[model samples]
Target: MPPEVIERDYGCGDPSKYLRAGETVLDLGSGTGKICFIAAQVVGPTGRVIGVDMTDEMLKVARTNAPVVAERIGYANVEFRKGRIQDLALDLVKLDEELQVRPITNAALFVQADGVAQKLRLKHPLVGDESVDVVVSNCVLNLVEPKSKRQLFGEIFRVLRKGGRAVISDIVSDEEVPEDLQNDPELWSGCISGALTEEGFLRSFNDAGFYGIQILKRDEKPWQTVEGIEFRSVTVEAFKGKQGPCFERNQAVIYRGPFKAIAATYAGEGNITQGGINMGSVSKVSHRALTEAFDEPLTRAQVMAIVSPFIRRATSTPA
Candidate 1:
């Protein structure tokens, strides 16, 4: 990092350090080009790093110093853009410039601008769909408004190429943030008021069709406490890649159990989910059966692994 970069740098951890060479990285809420510059080295000259932030001053700081960082790193592969992470397809800077050319003064003008913005999103998305190999954010996702959280995660999913992943470090609440705490503007900007519950954070990734969710790190102690709620930092890694169709290939899956014991089976000529499932285990899952059943949407390979033994045994049996 350059001298100016080191001075203005801020983050919970070094998510960029995990990037591989020749990658196309998208740094969400990249504050001052520090992480983007660091990532530039990891991705090498052939790769690219795009930093997206809504703050004009921060964007200016980042863009001005981009050349200095590039010279130091021996590559000019980093670019800064104006955008909200939640709505990556809409480039606010482009919209602003367009508006300046034709300022909206009435309802008709406002409606026309909206139409133009919609066309702009489709034509020159702030971040193109499936264009990025990696998405990394540090203490930023939590700062998104609650109503926009789903959009934010969806944008992450939309930008990532299949098999690409998102590595995020941010604060999470031990419990849901109360309405009063969530309403505090200071806390919201400080990355506290809009924090998701740890479980809720994982569920969001699942909701956005990501899998292999893993927690890379978690702070040992709470960063802050609000109304008896503990908020702490955690680095989460979630991957995107669940493509293709479902086909019955003589596969079966029997969930293993030690929680409680009884047995059930549901296998037939066309419906083979073989073996005895522990019905007694129902009590253990009764509280949240439906919700937990599809928590980690298994991949095709995962399903094959679970039923491989059955397939092997049946193949070797007499016909």
Candidate 2:
């Protein structure tokens, strides 16, 4: 990585460690391209890494340093794009180029510009659907505006291929952040005010229809505290491809010792409890069995074998 990128980088945790070789990766809010550069090397020459950021200055620095990193690594598999994380389909760079030709200076032109943007989104999306193998972010999710956060998660889920996963590292508050704190520009810019509660952070993934959600890491010490609200760093991993039809194969899985009662989403229904007892319907039990199996001392192949029949390619359009 270039010294310029390293100096300008800001993050709470390393999501690159979770990446695998030869996988396509998307780095959200990739300021200075630090994480993208690291991910490029980790994913190797066969893999590809795309960084997206809305800031022009950050994008400029990243685009400039990209060639240097590629030269050092002897391959050019990393590129940066300009767009909002929430709306990955709209290419802001392309919009800028179009605006230079047909500038929007009046109300009528502005409305026309909106149509042009929509056309660009349809014709040339910044990130295509079901295109990436992994989506990674480092301490940047909280920077998104509160109203657009749901769309942000949906965009992450949209660009991912079936069975693809997201590894995110961000600050989470122990308690809900107060409205006053959230409204403060300084706190929000500092990545403090917009922090979601730890439970809410995980729940957001669940609500986004991601399964096998797990906390890869959580800092023991608080990163910061505001008005008795403790904020700490946490790395979360969630998988896509849980949406599909459930077929009964008369499969049964024995629950090992662990939690007395646990809830899971399966068969397009609400929580199903399993309390150290055998459960049926392999197709219905989506996350709990897979999550528990992963928590145990089982290999990736073994874990896949356990959920292979249950896993199906998602057919519905991404939210």
Candidate 3:
């Protein structure tokens, strides 16, 4: 990483640690491309990393340092783009160039420009739909305006491929910030006022249809305290592959009692059979019945039939 990038980095945690090799990664609000550069190395030469930021200075710093990092690492797999994290489709740099050629000065021209932006979003998105294997962010989500936060999460979800995941590290509040604090310009700019409550942050991912959400890390100590509100850094991981049809496979899983009772839900709406008992949803059968049904060897055709749905579901492209 370049000294400039390190100097400008304001991240609360390292999301790159969660990334895997040979995976396409997108870094939201990737200031100075620090995380993007780190992710490029982790993902190796076969993978690609893109950094998106709305600030020209940040983009410039990131773009300038990208080649240096690539040269040092002996491969170039990272690039920086100019765009808002909440609206990943619109390339602000491209839009600016287009506007220069045809500046909007009137209401009619403004409407025309809006149409142009839409066309650009459709034809040449900065980040394409279901394109990235992973989306990672560091200390940036809290900086987005509250009104645009939903769109930000939706954009993250939109760009990720089915079965892909998002690993995000951001500041979360112990309690909701008051309107007075939220409206404070200094606090909002400092990444304090716009912080989501810890539960709200996870709920945002859930609302965006991400499953298997987990908090990878949460700081034991608050990073900042304002008006009795304790704000700390938390890293969360969430998956994006629960939008397919359910099939009845008559599968039953035993619950190793950590809890008195457990109920599980799947995208296909299946029930978990535990200890010869049906929990809920789908079909129910005793353990002996399930075992006896599959006790006989399955012919080749029967085996294919049994697994074909899973194979198709895994390979099918996301809409």
Best by TM-score: 3
RMSD of each: 9.0, 11.0, 10.5
**In what order do the candidates fall by lDDT, top score first?**
2, 3, 1
- Candidate lDDT (C-alpha), each: 0.80, 0.86, 0.85
Query: Residue by residue across 1-319, what tens digits does model 2's lDDT show?
Result: 7899999988999999999899999999999999999999999999999999999999999999999999999999999999999999999989999999999899999999999999999999999999999999999999988898899899999999877889999999999898999999999889998898999999988788787789999999999989999999999999885466655444344445355544555234533334222233334344344645422235689989987766653344365
Candidate 3 regions exceeding 4 Å error are 249-262, 266-270, 275-319
Q: Taking the tens digit of each residue's C-alpha lDDT, what string does model 3 give over 109-148?
A: 9999999999999999999999999999999999999999
Give me candidate 1's TM-score against the actual structure.
Answer: 0.77
Q: Comparing 2 and 3 by lDDT, which wins?
A: 2
CA RMSD (A), model 1: 9.0
* Counted clashes in each candidate structure: 1, 0, 1
Give the per-residue lDDT digits (tens) of candidate 1, residues 1-319: 6577678766777788778999999999998988898889999998999999999889988999998887876779999999999999999988999999999999999999999899889999999999999999988898888899999999999999976889898899899999999899999877889999999998998788776678988998999888899999998988776343334444333444333432221111121122422332221222122214313336789999999999999999998
At residue 151, candidate 3 shows an lDDT of 96
Give candidate 1 misplaced runs (Cα > 4 Å).
248-319
Clashing pairs in 2: none
Candidate 1 clash figure, as a count? 1
User: For model 3, which pairs clash?
Assistant: 246-268
